[model samples]
Target: MDSRGLIIGMIILLQTTVGILGNFFLLSHYLILYYHECSLKTTDLILKHLTMANTLIILSKGVSHIMTAFGLKEFISEIGCRFSLYVQRVGRSMSIGSTCILSVFQAITISPRSSDWKGLKTKAPKYIGLFLSLCWILYLIVNIIFPIYLLNKKVKSQNMTKAKSFEYCSPGDRDGIMDSLYMALFVFPEVLFSVLILWSNGFMVVILYRHKKQVQHIHSTNVSFRASPESRASCTILILVSFFLTFYTLSSILNACIAFLNSPSWWLVNINNIISMCFPSFGTLVLMNNAPTFSRFCFIWIRNKKSPNFKVAM
Candidate 1:
């Protein structure tokens, strides 16, 4: 009815749509990965796993958010809350882990043959499953205590203090320390991944420029696309990194606004929190679709063609 209500509604609508679409596309990717032998490359597997994690995270948070929007805060019981929270946290953490690994993997893949990282390509594929397994186990262990301590069906009123907030573990206990430690664990990895992604992309840009100059020196008349699919995969990775950075910045700014405003306006707070989720939902769709090079490759091959390249071989 008011401007704030309108904003919240729009945010929910956009997030729900994007979540549905993204999940569908993720499922499609999984099916392709499983059925297509040629698509079983290590990077494809990594992206598939990342997509799966992203889908779960979206589903867990998006469903709860929709219920909250619809005035159904108690849509799930206490046990449900614990389970949902556990799954959501694990899924979210796995998404972060996968992205971090992907950045490092890309950097290694692009390294020259003389570089030490060139040897990593042989080992990385073999270890992808191991990395995924470790992520699942680590997050599961860290999150298991949540259901034991925090979730209860006895609904408490939303008080003015953050002190009364629902928690699976006591802030005074070892669980609190573990929580802080888990947050710290992600900080360095996240920063490292972000930096590696930036650096890898920078190097690729410079190489492309130099390659273009070399081509021009030959007095070539035809326009040439120099990037291989592997290089294009790096571009996809860059798009993903950009997507993550954009929302991370936006959410951080909005979170700071909420903390500083210190207002008791329920509608305003709700809208603010909802915006943080909505943009990422939309962003996942954009990033996935931005892989035009991949899409064209898929289309040509799926059509039973040998190659997708017009002027050269794919």
Candidate 2:
């Protein structure tokens, strides 16, 4: 491999390794919790789904790029290409949908006692399964086109026509009508989810601000301003949403450029793949930082081994 290829391969390997480990730890922690309690909180259920999706995203995207970078693209067959792309797209859609649901659920959970949506807090858990089921169904339906059109064909040159193809797979046959329909179906749901997430987070922020003001009014002297669990959860979800959006938007822009450019740079393709997996890799660590149980477990173990008197501030 050339220097550029070697560097890209190393980066992909690093990202895949770290992402898999972080997500595996998260999944294991929750599985243990679920086994002991025999029930999952609504948020926990959403998180479990998100972790699973993130793992698939990392695996599908990472393995493809690694294979390309290492000149092993010939190992992937047409079926493999179809399956990988299908799974990647489905996982991506699920991540977006699950995050939106999580944000909305947290907003409802933390709504003021007299707020219009407060009643949802009591009933939301019952519908989590339904919502997740719908998410899977919706994404599966929208992305079924992948397997129909994707082929394992080698590209001889890096030209505009082949820029949309993966290293081991040819770009799927594109019809104007089908492309328009696909874009409409995909964009509509994504835009709707984005708006919902933004609205939910915005509402929670307002609630937190008002609560802070009320607390200040109630205790004029020496008031502790510790964040509540709800507030912390809201903040974490907001951060996750923000990161996902940023990465997704950048990837979309790069993809659009690649589509239009007569000769897209090979490095741009590598960068796009790297950006695509960033959220799944780093977002898992972000989540771990906010998970009280996981954080506490790590702290206690580290403390016992290093300093007996060490305390976790959170």
Candidate 3:
């Protein structure tokens, strides 16, 4: 109820609102396309998964933060804490994994015909469903550790040296074996996917550069050095991956600091939560802007509404 708390609540409220609207719009747009077209492109499928994951993440974290900010943490029972944390972790992992897959898929799709990865371009679309299923299973197994140690306990007036799973939950039990297992299962996959995203991004950049050189040499006048659709898609994926990495890294570092501090600031914890929520919140808008079809529709809709006499050219 203090000024700082109010400010944080307002910020989270804004993020939650924007995130819900953007993600809902993106998801609904794709659903309409899939329903009418009777099938989805590979990228569209991946995007649908990403939007679902992002929406869950926003709801889980955003609502929890708002409740805490408003001094209504009691509503989150022990079961609620366990379920919300588990869902949040799963959603976070899915966001990372799906984005990584999307990047790699684009890399393969845009690979040179002579490249080894070129063969996957035709077969990748067939396996997207399987890949997404596996991702959910993997993350679910990893986060099953949540409810084991998460307890709904009141926050006592005591200095803490580490972070708890939730504001209303007790500090996580100190089991070295469980801690190591969690790291291996949770952290390992995140690091692996992040590395894959970076590698795929680099490969796509190199391929695009070489292709541009070839196109220029073949016809300096006939071909303009404009970004191809593949290049634009790759760039958008790269931006998304970069943003996720930045936000995740910052939140991780802050969490680490909080773990070591003898007296962790509550505001710092709120800030970390806010940072964790940023990727899902703003990343949807990035996807909307980068999507040509959606962007065109939005442009035409807005322009026509604003100027009744104006017409958009196809």
Candidate 4:
């Protein structure tokens, strides 16, 4: 393979590896929390789903990417192609929906107790589980065209006269009308989720700014107002969302270029792979670095390690 191909392969390998491990760490943490602590917060529940979806996106997108990067085309059968594409799209849609859900809920969570959404915040989690389930079903059904229109690249090489070919899969021809229909079917949910995220994120920022000013006024009167952990977590979400939007926008641009190009450049395709996986790979680390739960566990682990007789005491 060429130097560029080798470089891309290595980058994809690293990203998928880290993403698999980091997201599983987050997922397993929640499992441990549920079993050990006997319960989970609603926010924790939402984050766990996000982590799972991220893991799904990484796995489905990563395998083909790594193989293609290494020049291992048509590595799977037609069935495999269908499965991968379906899972990848569903996972991506789920991640988008989950992030929007988390942001909107957090905004409500930090809202003033006397606000209009006061009672809704407490009651929201009760129905969120069912809502996410319905959404997953909806996404799966909506993307069913993937399996129907796709065949392994190696399966019908001679017959694909007007189809777009991926590294390992070939999809049926999309005429102008079909293309527009497909765009509407898929892009609608994405646009809707993005709008929700932006609105909720803006609300959270405004709430935070107001809170900061209130704290400043209290300080001036010699009455200290400490920032709550919830506020800190909201700030973290804002930072995380900013990073996500940056990576996602870049990834989307690369995707658009590939779609619009006569024959997509291999370099652009490889760069898109890296950009797509960047957030899922390192987002977990960002969360752990700023998260109170992880820090608390680390502190405990360290303290226990330093105490030679800790086991005996216990």
Per-residue accuracy of model 2 over 1-22 as CA lDDT, tens digit each: 7998999899988999999999
Clashing pairs in 1: 150-168
Q: What is the C-alpha local distance difference test score of each model?
A: 0.62, 0.80, 0.80, 0.80
For candidate 2, the lDDT comes to: 0.80
Reference-based TM-score, model 4: 0.88
lDDT of 4 by residue, 11-74 (tens): 9999999999999888877886676566778888888888888998899889988888888876
Predicted structure 3: lDDT: 0.80
Evaluated at residue 224, the lDDT of candidate 3 is: 55
TM-score of 2: 0.86
Off by over 4 Å in 3: 149-171, 217-225, 297-314
User: Cα miss at 167, model 3 (Å)?
Assistant: 3.6
Model 3, position 164, has a per-residue lDDT of 51
Q: Model 2: runs farther than 4 Å from truth?
A: 151-166, 170-173, 218-223, 297-314
lDDT of candidate 1 vs native?
Answer: 0.62
Worst 10 residues of 1 by lDDT: 164-173
lDDT of 3 by residue, 1-314 (tens): 78888888889999999999999999888876665466888888998899899998998888988888777878977677778878888888899888888888988898888878766878898999898988888778868776654443333445333445445433444457656876887788888988898898888889888887877765667665677787788788778778878898898898777666656678778888789889999998888777787877566566667998885442
Model 3 lDDT-worst window of ten? 152-161
